[model samples]
Target chain A: MVEAFAVASGKGGTGKTTSTLALGMALAEEYDVTVVDADTGMANLLFHAGLADVETTLHDVLVEGGAPVEAATYERFGMRVVPCGTSLAAFEAAEPERLRAVVADLAADADVLLLDSPATLGSKSAILPIVLADRVVIVLQATIPAVSDGLKVQEYALSYGTDVAGTIFNRVRGDVESAAEKADRYFEGPLLATVPESEAAQQARAAGRPLLAHAPDSEAATAYRAAAARLDPRDGDSGDVADRFRSAVVPDPP
Target chain B: MIPEGELLRSRVVTDLATALEDVLDRHLDGYAVLAPRETLLGAADGRGVLTFEDGVPACAYHVETDRGGPAALGDVGAGPYRFELYALEAAALEIAHDADELRVPPGMPAERLAGDPALATRTRRRAGVDADRPDDGGALEAFLEDEATVERIRESARREARRRAEEWGLGDALADRPDG
Candidate 1:
């Protein structure tokens, strides 16, 4: 069985990359998880996943007649990670639609696939992960823009026939229980976890490691683990998922 | 009600923090009027009125909702909002600022509206030294509880999603596409 989740937020600086890898690491203990940095335009997962030194990446797999998907896949922190390169020329040279086939190929072997999605819903490439995912995990901060943009993301996912797995309130400060309760009313899924802002998360990023791997005992890591537990991964035939991705109708490049 | 001052800035800002941070950094003795850019209630539905003293938030009021203080902050939900900042003499706002019922803590706007904790902390520190106003929380909860505004946000997003789906040629993927 395979379930793909797009860990997404509409706005930036919401610790999306951190939350994605943390969730990926926590879920890895229970399932064979594969994480893909689908945010090709502004790919930073390579830095976070410690794959910054990798010679090949999703960029290589995306360009025509480039590397196979397996070449870019790296086993790190007990999960399969496919990080995107940061080179502007590479990003420009890569084809966005190639992500569909790559995700499909990765979907065939993993029990869970987590797509670290782009922060904006601005372009086809940005929204494609959400459109293709079986479900989305909305990451939010208890502020107007974050929540507002989060609502926009949720609506976009629902409109595209994607289910909302749940919401993770990241970088929370003080008590947000009341706000979380109020927010849960608007979202399709439950409030999975509220991760407090932590210096450990920032330090982990600087150390080029996921929070869970760097500071497993930190409050943020614990919250991410709790979030993973609450995320009830559903059963979907990997063959069907792969075929759907391979056949998913994406618009022609401009 | 407070009297107006000279207009300093007026434009549509996607993030309220830009306006708030500007007000804070400039130490401007002024006020700002924030109105939702897209709303069935129009810009007049409820224009949020926030006053600042030395770039620290002093008081808040929602014109249409007839609510004051932190609740007014809630009335001013997500942006991009039409933000207009007006410069005022400290003497001009002195009396109006005394209305404790209409007062908001220094960091509430940054915290609740901007969702910027760093700005909130800075504002709080500035408030601690510049102004000693009592603090309160729950604007996010208040915004969420305003079912009408929340529904409006969701409704507008849904509309935008479907409209953009067509533009991006992903209309067929829409769950409620006419032909689907």
Candidate 2:
């Protein structure tokens, strides 16, 4: 039973790409995971995957419709990354519905797919994954504006009918939980999980490596791993939070 | 009581905006911190937006290297800022990887939420299409609706926050606190 999760942000820089690879990696540990760079406008998940020879890409499926999902897939780091080829123009020009059809074909190749998207639903075609994704995981910042944008995106997705699995509080620090809470309240689902703010992610993005792989033991890395646990297909306790915190996340899967 | 993790994170963002505001006050009349509709429009407004998902605070330089040529999103300035904000997209990856403990505050009012049953049904239908033949057009229409809603709600949120602060004293004591 494969599941498709669309990783879209109301804005960029919400740790969408990094989370995609990390989650895919974590899931790959148990399930066959595939990460697709839906950011055809700026397809860079390959950079996050730390793979340079992304000779084959998502464009083949969208434009040429040449390869089946497996052909467009790149198995790396023990996972498959369906890179958004280097052609932004092609992706932008491709029809939104056609792209969705292509991705659907592509999703068939993997048990779990992470569709990485760009910020803003600017291009109607660009957002195919948001509403179509089996689980829409909205990424949020801890700021009033960031939270607001996230809430709006989630609300909109829900309104238009997207299964907003939950909110991902990224780049959070000492006080973001409240901001995230406000967002969770208005959003149609739970604020499910959060990622502690860390410099490690910046370092990883620059170095082109997953934080877990590069700084495996860093607090940020551990936090990333914990976040992955919450997204797991399995339902149970991760035992990483305060007892009260544990109960807060487990019972509510919005 | 501050929920330092959440409050501090929000404070830092406000702090960043204030810092930007100072720059704007001293340099420009009104500068917008262009971000996706998903970005907190509560900050200064800007038509040109950048991805700021990281929670750590750092000043990025607007390094204009090329026009219609290759340009990299560059950070040119460095300062002793208090905190940082992670790019939300990247955070999603970390969460998926089970890297960090993406904890929602124990204080979030989850009980107050109202799930949009439509979302689940739509997702189910898409899931069916996803498994076989996903209608890309349908997805696109849906995505547009979501995106449009994101921008609209962001606007509503900005107004709401302002209302709360002005009428409800949300930022009453914090006004005296060293926000930036």
Candidate 3:
């Protein structure tokens, strides 16, 4: 069985890449998780996953007549990671439509697919992960603009018929219980977990490792594990998921 | 209601912390009006009034929502705002400051409105606050309570999504595509 999730936040500075890797690591304990850096334009999952020095990435697989998807895939931190190159030239050369095929290929081999999506909904390419995913897990910071942006992304995902898996309130300080409780009312899913602001999370990024690997004892890591527990990836026929991805209509480049 | 004060400085500022810091540095006794030219939430007419005691925020109010204190801070949207700082006498602000409903924690404005935690800590220190008072999230709670604003955001996003779907050739995937 396989389920694809687009881990998205409408705007940046919400620790989305970190959350993606953290969730992937936590979920990998019980399932075969394939994490893809679907944010081709601003990919940082490589840095967070310690795959920054990999020779091939999603970008290499996305170019016309490019490398096979398997060539870009790596086994890292107990999961399969498809990192994206941080080169402007690679991003410019890569065709966004090829992502559907790549995700379809990965879906066949994994129990769960987590797309580390772009932080914006401005471009078709950026919104593609949300469009293709079975559900979206919105990452949020407890601030006005962050929540507002999260709400907007949720609407876009719902409009395209993607389910709201849940929301993770990241980098939280002080009491956000009341706010998160109230905000949960507007969301279709529960408040999965509130990840506290942690120096370890920042240090993990600097060390080029997932937070679970770098500091499993940290509160943030504990919260991530709880989030993964709450996710409860639904049973989906891998063949059906793969076929859906393969059959998905590719949008025109913006 | 706050008594009118002498105009000290007025300018459009994108960052709210800078204006707050200026007031703190000058140790000004007065109030400031923050009127966003356009809010991120699409509410342009809403404005926040923050009164300062020795440059530390003492009370707050939002003109459009008729909300005061922490809730008013929630009403203050992300800025590129017309910030009008005025100088007022301490005694003149005494009545408004004494209104419990309008009083805000000294650092609440910095933390909630500016999204700057460090600035909040500093402001708390400057105001002689104990620093352990947990933020009740009154501002965000208030923001969530504003159903009209939230609905506007959702409605706008829905329209944008539909329009973008057509533009990007993803109209077939929309939940309610007419042709489908």
lDDT winner among the candidates?
1
Count the clashes in each prediction: 0, 79, 0
lDDT of 2 at A155: 47
Q: In what order do the candidates fall by DockQ, top score first?
A: 1, 3, 2
Backbone clashes in model 1, listed as residue pairs: none
- List model 1 lDDT by residue over A22-61, tens digit each: 9999999999999999899899899998988999999999
lDDT of 3 by residue, B46-66 (tens): 878999999999999998888
Q: If you assessed candidate 1 against the hidden native complex, which CAPRI class would it receive? A: medium
Model 3 per-residue lDDT at A231? 95
Model 2's CAPRI class is: incorrect
Model 3, A1-254: lDDT tens per residue? 99999999988889999999999999999999999999998889999988888899889999998999999999999999999999999888898888898899899999999999999999888898898899999998777777888998999999998999999999898898889988898888789899998999999999999999999999999999999999999989988888878877775553
Measured with C-alpha atoms, the lDDT of residue A30 in candidate 1 is: 93
Chain A TM-score relative to the true structure, per candidate: 0.98, 0.81, 0.98
How many angstroms is residue B164 displaced in model 3 relative to the true structure, after the best TM-score fit? 2.0
- What pairs collide in candidate 3? none
Comparing 1 and 3 on DockQ, the stronger one = 1
* lDDT agreement with native, every candidate: 0.88, 0.48, 0.88
| lDDT preference between candidates 2 and 3, better one | 3
Sort every candidate by TM-score, greatest first.
1, 3, 2
